[model samples]
Target: MKKGGTAGTGATGRRGLLKRAAFGGVVAATGALAAPQVSRAQTVTWRFQSTWPARDIFHEYAADYVKRVNEMGGGRLRLELLPAGAVVPAFQLIDAVHAGTLDGGHGVSAYWFGRNKAFSLFGTAPPWFRDANNYLGWFHYGGGEALYNELITDILKLNVVGFQNGPMPTQPLGWFKNPIERVEQLRGLKFRTVGLATDLFNELGAAVVALPGGEIVPALERGVIDGAEFNNPSSDRALGFPDVAKVYMLQSFHQHTETFEILFNKPKFEALPAELKAILKYASESNSADMSWKLQDRYPKDLLEMTQRQGVRALTTPRPILEAQLQAWDRVVARLEGDTSSPAAGPFFKKVCDSQRDWCRRTGVFFLRNEAPSVLAFNHFFARG
Candidate 1:
């Protein structure tokens, strides 16, 4: 039994050594084969179009979003930024996205209010919510997202993605040639506004015109409109509003927080693999965060500069006018609620407003009064700075 023991042991050791060598070789081959696949998976390209001017911060957010996505995706997703007029007419962005003519676009939600008055609720309102955090909370956690996506995917049948432009701050009521001291001043006053606000403005006996970003300046120049509201102070000044109009009034009560969107063609979005869809969603949310921070810092500073540099006079909105406007808005909500076609919109609107109001009453009052040190610390720093 012992005769061949040493010889058999040597043979078994040799076979074991060969098996180890084979496994090592197979692992090396697998590593080599997988390397290129991993590299190839790191590349993707997309295009984003916007109606905003290339120089506007609103558009700047779009550019930043591309960079953030590319970085966060570790070079897997690449988005190319296209200024207004690159893919389609700036005004036709919503249509382009819906038709799959373009990948996606940057546009204000109010622009599509023509599709339904209920759509305007996402943007802003007269005598409604003002704080940016409240607005963000409404969209993300207040059932607004569910209602919004359903409105697009279920009702309009488009694959639309949206994000916050954040609150544009207390916007100037508008550029006006005369003081609107009396309610009578509103009658026959031509204003530029979109959505259900137009109906409310009409009810107040004022004429409202819907115009695109490019058209507003020309219309103001030509006296097509007596007053206009485009955006915040910096944006308005950039558009040369000061040169054309005399009075820069305070607080866009009608637009406390206007939400904007970047809509994608539903079919195109759905066709993507799950990972790519995720990349898009993360990109949008990241964009919202970045934009909110920037605007919060930039808006108040810009307004201060306007007052100091341009000699812009800030007119206060009369309290009575604001109260009456709120009353009228209540009627607008009630009338829309009675119409069954927008049943979802009615409850959704009420819920957001109620939530926002509750937050305002509980926390907002102290913040505005500055009774609590932590209250509105961010707003105070920015406004005072």
Candidate 2:
């Protein structure tokens, strides 16, 4: 009887232990189901475009910006870059981005000059900057951003966010069918240029035709325009400028210093996480520095190739013409400053130009005075003895 009783007790205890174990298992599963699950962040993709033809170095520069952002973003963010005219024409980039047709774009601020002439003050007009780098310094540090915000938000009412990057070297006087030796040569010349440079050339007596970079070569080929300027040597070579024009006139005050503008839809950009926003900002900075280095390397090589091998005659634009361009800029500034009409470039134009000029007075003068003429160093080191 004692052995049977002990066996029954052990059996009962074993059953109780098994039931508790099963209950513990159910509780663990329930806890797991109730607790938050860990998963990867959802990847975001932006449809981006460039206001440049596919082959142009400008487009490549745009690609560089996109690459930096994408790699830094890892899988969390992706930017798909399309060439100009993929979704909208190059000039319409701001509008498209504003309307969410494109999430973002690479373009110059000057492209929006039609909306407000003050747009040119950001990167396209005046010779106040000692160089593109100085121009960028002004934009980033010299109260330019506040004014820019005012223009975009308070004035133009465009639903966009923009960052200024890609400091362009001084643009050339432009391409010509024949070398221009005199200021008089500009009169009645049909020239292709965009931005306030169009007004500058127009001021100098050229019948200005504002064509996008892609159309310049074709227009030149068809005799639709006689001369054009499209940024630097790599882009000029890429766009077949040599095939159409033999004389490449270098240096100009029109777009003395310029930078590319990277724009985003305000809503879309704001919707991004703080980490991603920081990525885009840093990416712009990275792109700017990288492009500066790359242009220093590539532009000289192409310029040499054009002059040495391609039978292209590259000439320094005559002093007379440059002085005349400066004068023209003065006139353009005055006219725009005086006009208080539809675009409201009058007071706004004065405001930006005054800011730039004050910044230049404090900064650019120092830069010019402190940096010895680079030509002297170039002649000392690289001059063929």
Best by lDDT: 2
Per-model TM-score on C-alpha atoms: 0.80, 0.90
RMSD of 1: 5.0
- Please report, as a residue range, the 10-residue window in candidate 1 with the lowest summed lDDT: 163-172
The Cα local distance difference test for each model comes to 0.72, 0.90
- Writing each residue's lDDT as its tens digit, candidate 1 over 31-54 gives 899886886686766677987877
**Backbone clash numbers for all candidates listed:** 1, 0
Clash pairs, model 2 backbone: none
- Candidate 1 is scored at a TM of 0.80
Q: Looking at candidate 2, what is the lDDT of residue 16?
A: 93
